[model samples]
Target: MKMWFLGTGAGRPNKHRNVTAIALQLPEPETGWWLFDCGEATQHQLMYVPLKLSKLEKIFITHLHGDHLYGLPGLLSSRSFDGGVTPLAVYGPIGLKAYIDTVFSLTETALDYEIVIHELEEEKQGIIYEDGRLRVEAGPLVHRVPCFGYRVEESDTTGPLLADKARALGVRSGPLFGKLKAGEAVTLEDGTVITPESVTDGVLRGRIVTVLGDTSPCEMAVLLGKNADLIVHEATFAAGLEEKAHEFGHSTTIEAARTAQLAGAKQVALTHFSGRYSNDELSQLVAEATAVFPHAIAATDLSMVKIDRVHERRAGQDEISS
Candidate 1:
């Protein structure tokens, strides 16, 4: 899995950054990718990356702010125009469906594919989406508006089959081997039963990623990001702006890092930067975060973070590439 930061500005766009938009690209066999917070010019930013609108499976909106959602209507229209035939699922706070419907009605626009909107209730927290391979949970955060944060947990995979051990136990390399690999016990022609655990390694644990919307430092953020491999938190101000940040329902770099540290997150990607700071000044913001949490980095526009499948839990830092 990988996260692509398409835009990373606080309230508005600037020459240095756009607004807030991030894409979580799943690994192969799952052709679709998920989007989080479609800010203005989000589709335009897509032009620079290899992601496709037709392959966009879901969209998760953080809040109703213009900077976080103004690009959604155009992006949905463009997806249809680009031949998106599959259905799309959009998850967000209440009133999101009305917002999209109003926009489409005003513009007299129609879509080619089905769009399902899930309106999350304020302060309601629980699992929002789940499938065989992955599960997503939502929790409320302390924001000016009713906002939510999501925790994505990938399901653990079965371990590889020990072919040599199976063969030694008189289990032929055929359908029986497939069944053993799937954790099913199989009886051979010789009446010998071979169990899955007896001929396979242990299961491989999956990775967890937490993505938060705009919010002040809150316990909900820490709960959502608990023990996550990566937490994408907003850091709208530098270290000395804690009072101003909390007053506006936002977090400073130090506060963001503190949340990550409290949550025991392995790495934190700080985004949603205020335009007051230029690109060159981001290093200072990162410095502030690293002082609290060693594995923290300031995310910039068009940067990407690769999350490898967790083989074993260890203490280390992940890298973000631009």
Candidate 2:
């Protein structure tokens, strides 16, 4: 799995950053990408990446801020024009359905595919989405209006069983190894029974990523992000301008870094930067965050972060016995 920052500017668009949007890309049986927040000019930003609009299956809106959702109508319209046929599910706070209706009604535009809107409330916190390999959850975020942060965790996978190890134990290169690899016990012609534990390792660990919407440093965010491989938080201000962040229900760079640190996240990527700051200023902002949490980085538009994958390998039988 990978996360591509489509737009990272906070309040508005800038020459360096466009607006708030991200593409969460996962591999097969969960192929395609899901978008979080569709800020202005989001389609244009997609041009930089090799994403097809038809493969955009899900959209999660954090809030109703114009900077966070202004590009929805345009992108939806463009999808229809581009011959997109796949239905899309859009999850957001209440009034999202009404907002889409009003925009489409006034613009006289129609989409070619089904668009399902899921209006979320604060009381709800669980699995909001589940597919073959993806499980996405939503939790409340502390914003001016109803806001939510999302945690996307891939389902666990068990990698290949050790063929050499199986052969070493008198298991031949036939269906017997396949059975043992699948965690099933098999009896050989010689009446020897081989168990799955004898030839295979345990279950492999999957990657977990948590993405925060516009929010302050809150307990809910920390809890949702706990033990995450990657924590992507909105950093709308530097520490010096923390008052502004508090006023707007956003996080400072330092606040984001500390949240990731407290959540035991392996890495943190700070985004949703205010456009007012220059490149040098944003660099300084990241430096400030790094001081607090060295694993933090200020993400740029179209930048991708590759997560570390953990696979299980069989231990030697001698070590297992020991």
For each candidate in turn, the TM-score is: 0.94, 0.89
Off by over 4 Å in 2: 28-30, 166-198, 312-322
Best by TM-score: 1
* Cα error of candidate 2 at position 142, Å: 0.9
Please give the lDDT score for candidate 1.
Answer: 0.91
* Candidate 1: clashing residue pairs, number: 0
- Estimate candidate 2's alpha-carbon lDDT, on a 0 to 1 scale: 0.86
Candidate topping lDDT: 1
Worst 10 residues of 1 by lDDT: 313-322
lDDT value, residue 101 of candidate 2? 92
Per-model CA lDDT versus the true structure: 0.91, 0.86
> What lDDT tens digits, residue by residue, belong to model 1 across residues 4-101?
99999999999999999999999766878999999999999999888999999999998899999999999999999888989999999999999999
Q: What digit string (tens of lDDT, one per residue) describes model 2 on residues 1-322?
A: 7789999998789888889999988765566888999999999999999788988989999899999999999999999887788999999999999999999999899889999899997657888988756788999988898889999887765556778888887899888877876668888779989888767665556789998899998998998899998999999888987788888899898999999999999999999988778766777988999999999888998999878666655564221110
